[model samples]
Target: MTQAKATSGFLDQVCWNSDGLVPAIAQDFNTGQVLMLAWMNRESLALTASEGYAVYWSRSRKSLWRKGESSGFQQRVHEMRLDCDGDTVLLLVEQQGGIACHTGRSSCFYQRFSDGGWQVNLPVIQDPEAIYK
Candidate 1:
């Protein structure tokens, strides 16, 4: 089958929201740690599958976001899976530069609920200023 045909078939299995978006979760391939969560539209999902990387639809910017386009922390997807309900996507990826979070942490879920409030449990892997600039 053609690449476009295959992509369309796969996309057809997903149940996208009214905005044509599905929640995508990026996870560490080896460690099984969730790195980040983003949203993807059909175009972004097809691009990600074809490009073998993470591509997301930025609701805020109303555009396609190529992961690591500016930060140089691209996620090389090892595998992709859809949830049973077909509402979410899981990407097992090798996080480049050992960093996934924009805050310079290994993962975006760095905050832990403490006894009273949220607390930072993970240290920043690198300075965000250096990573972005």
Candidate 2:
């Protein structure tokens, strides 16, 4: 019997850490804005490419999970890139439905400190329950 071919081309080149994980940065393809940063193991990487959605490994949770799985806001991948060192991944994505952040903001980096303290740059686009439910 013929062996099945692996679709994960260049995956062997990636530099996974001692924990078998790599950092993944999600960015907006259109806006060139960074949405979020997360970690991914081999399984998450394969799942993200195959499933065509952003999947990541949660270090704290110690499991695999699809981004926005519990939320209605999903990130459809536009492109996946590897950094020069091949230790990091950049995922250009187009978010669906609503904001990407759990705080209901468009991005996690919506806060900017002015002369003194932090300030909210953008208001919450939707309620957490609305997207999470």
Candidate 3:
């Protein structure tokens, strides 16, 4: 097979969603805490694998979002896994700066749905304005 065909086949194994995206989850390698969930396209997945860092498809920005490019909270990948159905990507990584959520918490899933409402479970590590500065 040609090189292009080979590359295409490799990525084709992934069951991309209707928008050509896959849900990627980054988990803390040491604590097993789920750091965040993001979307990834073929290009971002390839870049993340090649660079050993978390790179995601920014749906809001409509471009590649290099983790920590602005917040200095990058994720150094330790391992990557594809789900059995090939529809999900799991990244075991060391989260730099001990922060993961854009809201300045350690994880994006910081809200607990208890008491019939969402409650804050984690405190903000750093102000987003400060981090994004």
Candidate 4:
């Protein structure tokens, strides 16, 4: 998070899946908000540590994606953590522009399960079209 270099073999220490990816969760450091969930390959995780930003492996695109590269709302890494099993990664970050979800909401986890139904709990801070374009 401090632009510290990821040690060699550090990526290997993570328990990678058969697909060579790990589940990554990004949280707002200041507000304790769960910003988003993503996937990170070795290279993306390494790059994220070295670059001090959120970089994820896009399963759909089959490529690495730097978060907010186009939306101008990059996540600055404040801390990186691994679950006890070492299969999941948690990143405490300062979210730029207060937007994390591609849908332009504060977080990807905008749904609440209540009354035996799923309800939207968060409002979109900005429209996707407005953010992406």
Candidate 1 residue runs with Cα over 4 Å from true position: 1-5
Q: Report the number of backbone clashes for model 2.
A: 0
Rank by lDDT, descending?
4, 1, 3, 2
Candidate 4: residue 30 Cα off by (Å): 0.6
lDDT of 3 by residue, 4-73 (tens): 2224465788999999999999999999999899999999988887778899999999999999999989
Overall lDDT per candidate, in order of appearance: 0.92, 0.85, 0.90, 0.94
Better of 1 and 4 by TM-score: 4
Collision pairs in model 2: none
Give the C-alpha lDDT of model 4.
0.94
Cα RMSD, model 4:
0.8
Clash totals in order: 0, 0, 0, 0
Worst 10 residues of 4 by lDDT: 1-10
In the order shown, the candidates' Cα RMSDs to the true structure are 2.5, 4.2, 4.2, 0.8
Q: Cα deviation in Å at residue 73, candidate 2?
A: 0.9
Ranking by TM-score: 4, 1, 3, 2
Q: Tens-digit lDDT track for model 4 on 27-46? A: 99999999999999999999
Q: What residue runs in model 3 are displaced by over 4 Å at the alpha carbon?
A: 1-9
| lDDT-better candidate, 2 vs 4 | 4
Look at candidate 1 and give me any clashing residue pairs. none
The prediction achieving the highest lDDT against the true structure is: 4
How far does residue 50 in candidate 4 sit from its true spot (Å)?
Answer: 0.5
